[model samples]
Structure formats: structure tokens, C-alpha cells
Target: MKTKFTAILLLQLLLISCSGTISTLKKEYSFNTSSSLKSNWNFNPKEWALEKDTLTGTGGPMHWGVIESRKQLPENYEINFRVNMTKESLFEVMLNLDKEKYIRTYLYQINQNIVIGDGVYDKKDDSYGKRGGKSLFTKPMELQNNKWYSVKIRVQNNQLYFSVDNKITLECSLEKSNLSQKGKLGFITNGETKITDLTIKTL
Candidate 1:
């Protein structure tokens, strides 16, 4: 009777420990820069800059150094953000897998079209695997220029779900990519754009 009781107690302790570990692994994002309108980030002339916006405070000219999350993120999690397109052009928020290079997955846009694409670097060929990569998903919805639109993305395992303005747009599953690396999350803009209320929650 004592042996059985001890075994049960041990099992309970193990379960509790695992639960605690999981709770710790799921973490909230610490925004590196919070902007109102005319906001400026780490002014690296070589990689990033800020452009003026007549409607908004300032448009971010993000290139390589304007990353938000340097901390490791949960593999399977949800990410959402509010982006204000002050100027009409192509933009993206990227989750990258390369430490030395910018190989990553991107949520893309050009005028009103939205797309999700991935880029990889090849080792054997010693070149970037896919130039613009392939579109995993696309949406016909048009984004209004100079308006704020809420974007939501859920990535769990190999599946991805994308939504705009609280409406489901596309869903896709990816064949496991060989290049696996924990990466930083950031925004990408070609002409001019502003981002705010960026929030990420773990599943």
C-alpha cells in the first residue's frame, strides 16, 4: 500500500513540474520601440532609417536592423499587429531563420494584394535557395492606403493561418524546411509604412 502511494505521489510531482516548465516557456514580447506617430528607432544609417509622413507621425524606413524581438519565441504560437499604411507600396512583417543572413518567411503586400512567402539559403549550391520564394497563400482583399488594418497570423507546427481586419483570408501547411533556426521578428517596408499595437501571444 505504501509503495503504491509513493508511486502516485511521484507521478503527480512529475506532472506539476512539466506544467511549470511549459508556463515558463510561453513568454510575452518586450517591444524595443513604442511609437505614437513620429517615432524613431536605432538610427543605423547602414541598415534602417525613418521617413516623414504627412498623415501619421513618421513612416519607418526599416531595412535590416529594425527587429523587435531578439528573445527566442515559442515554436508554435500566434502573432498579430496593427499596421498603418501611410504610403502606398509593398511591405511585410518577417520571421527570419538566419543569423548571418535574412533567410525567413514573410507576410507580403503590394498595393492591395497580400501574400505569404518563404526564403531559404542553400548549402550545397552555395546560394540563396529561392529568390522571392513561393507564395504559400494570398488574399484578394485590398488594404486601404493611410488606414490602419489589423493583421493576425497563427503559426503552429507546419500550419499557418492568416487574417486581415478580423476576417479569415488564407490557410496553408508547409513541408518542413531543412533550414531550422530560431529567428527575430521584424517589419519590412519598401516605400513608407507605420506599425503599432504589435502583440504576440503563445499557444
Candidate 2:
């Protein structure tokens, strides 16, 4: 009986230790200059700039590109940013980037059509593998071009939360074992985009 009691106590202690780091730590960010923005990112297609505290990028032949953080992110945290567009475009937040695989949370719009959704994707051998991609699980919201939208994302414990304009709009489980606890955080865009106020904080 004493041995069994001791085993249970050890299990409890393990659970507590795990939960200790689940309490997130915050990251601070402020837009000041072009160097500050460049210092925090790694981008492809190599045609992007930060001017007047706004970041703009456009240089991919396929009209698509990715800009990733220089540092990896913690497992559980909140990230927020504001974006604007001059024309129809696709914008995405790529998180938990474990090698060539990651989770994509996107807000896509084209000539008055819009979608707010997410998917799991892998890029290997010049091909894309998508599994359980619920790319449109909600209604399309009418968004004005050249107008900024406040977007927020949070991952805590076993769930992912999404919000726009300060309203929570979606939730999904983070159940994939391959999804790493530490990975790159970044944004994907097609053609032209202007982003500002990128901030992240731990849960």
C-alpha cells in the first residue's frame, strides 16, 4: 500500500512540473525602424522593406512568399498583428514550424470574397501535403481593402484560439505529436501586404 501511494505522489509531482512551464512567458515588440524589422525576420523572394514603421513585401513569381522570425517561439503563447492590403491577397500565419511542416492560419480575400480558416501542410519534394485542412470552417467576413484589421492568435495547453477585431471566432485542438514545442513563427503572403504592430506574449 505504501509503495502504491508513493507512486501516485510521484505522478502528481510530474504533472505539476509540466504545468509549471505551461504558464507562458511574454515577448515584447515595438516598431521603430527598418533595421528593427529586418533584425527580426528571414524572408524569401528577397523583396521586402520596412519604412515608416510599416512592413511591405512583394517579389515572388508565384505571388506567394514567407517571412519568418529570426528566433523560435515558445509552445504556448499569444501573437497579434495588424495588416492592410491595397488589392486582393492571401495572408497567413505559419506556426510550429518543425522542419518542412507547419500549421497555417490564414485570412484570405479576393475581390470581396474572404475566408478565415486554418490547415496542416507539409512541403516536401516540390509537393504539398495537406491533412485535415479545414480551410473554411466559418462564414466569410466582408473586409475593406486598404483598411487594417486587428488579429489575435493564442495557443494554450491543447487548444488553439483565434480572434479578429477583439472578438473570439474560432477554436481547434493541437493534437499532433510532431508539432514541436519550439519552432519558428512567421507570416506568409502573396504579392503585396502591409503589416504593423506585431506583438507576441506567452500564455
Candidate 3:
């Protein structure tokens, strides 16, 4: 009798957990405008320490982030945005899980408006590591300071593709990344940066 009761209780708990996750995903959410930023998106403008507000095609945000726990997204998702930055500023975007413990990062920066390229980071070593993808590009991407570039990231299964303006730039794969599955999405910058039309679509 005791074993039977335990089994029944476990079944009930499992059903409840699955139902909760399904409900969370059913709701449609977006963050492009100020209204969306305040309602669904979670970010603190003060945390980034605002310098000034810049413009884009649509609503632009200085910085944005959402907690891993609050997000119930699919395993595969695409993050695309138009990023603009100054020569003195740096641009870094990442998908972080376990809060500040672990992060898989993709960075684009312009220093003195001279060199521009793609960078991957592993939080475990506190270092910038090599990128993972299928193919490699010969020339590094040239980014203009105070200008916007269309960036797209597609994470299908274990493969990741980074492209600029629908052009294939660098392709890499992350086999041992802690963020193997979907979690939190974060955009961070130290100097000055602007992001607009940020969209997260999942398959």
C-alpha cells in the first residue's frame, strides 16, 4: 500500500510540472518598443549606467535582460538585431544560465574604428575562446563606428551560425558549452551601444 501511494503521488507531481511549462510557453511575448520593454522584458537602465539614448529603425533599448527562471523558451531559437556602437565602446551579447555562474558569449567590437571581428567567450576560464561553426570566413567583418549592422544568430541543435546582413560570416559549434539548452538572454556593453528591433523567435 505504501509503495502504491508513493507512485500515485509521483505521477501527480509529474503532470503538474509538465502542465506548468506548457502554460508558460503558450503566452506570446516580445520586446521591441518601450511598452514591451516594461511589460514582458526585464532590464534596468541604471544598471548599464546610461550615457545617452540613440535611435534605430524602431524602438531601441540601451540594455535588456531576462532571468533564466522566468523564461520557458524552446530548445532552438533565433536572436537577430541591429547593433550600433561607437569606436570607444564595446558590444557583447550572451545567453546566460545559472545567473552569473555560466555564460556563452558572442561579441563584436570596434576599437578606434580600425579592427572588427567575432569573438566567443567561455566563462569557466574567464577568457575569450575560439568560435564554433561549420565554415570560416577569410576577411573579418568591418564595422563602422556609430553605424548599424544587421546581425543574426541561429542556434539549431548543437550548431550555431553567426551572420551579418544575411551574409555568412563565421560558423562555429559549441560542443561543451554549459548553455547547451536554452536559458536566459542578455545584452551587455561597457562603453556605449544601441540595439533596435531585437527579436527572439523559436521553432
TM-score of each: 0.59, 0.69, 0.56
Worst 10 residues of 3 by lDDT: 50-59
Pairs in clash, predicted candidate 3: 132-172, 132-173, 133-171, 133-172, 133-173
Q: Write the per-residue lDDT of candidate 3 for residues 155-200, one digit (tens) a residue.
A: 7776666667775355445454334354555554554566665556
Worst 10 residues of 1 by lDDT: 52-61
What ranking of all candidate models by lDDT puts the best one first?
2, 1, 3
Error of 1 at 168 (Å): 4.2
Which candidate comes out best when scored by TM-score? Answer: 2
What order do you get sorting by TM-score, best first? 2, 1, 3
- Candidate 1 residue lDDT tens string, 39-155: 322223343433332112222333222333345556676776667756645556556445433323343445355776665433223234432355555667666667777888777
Which pairs clash in model 1? 37-57, 38-57
Number of clashes found in candidate 2: 0
Which segments of candidate 2 are over 4 A away from where they belong?
1-31, 59-61, 111-136, 176-182
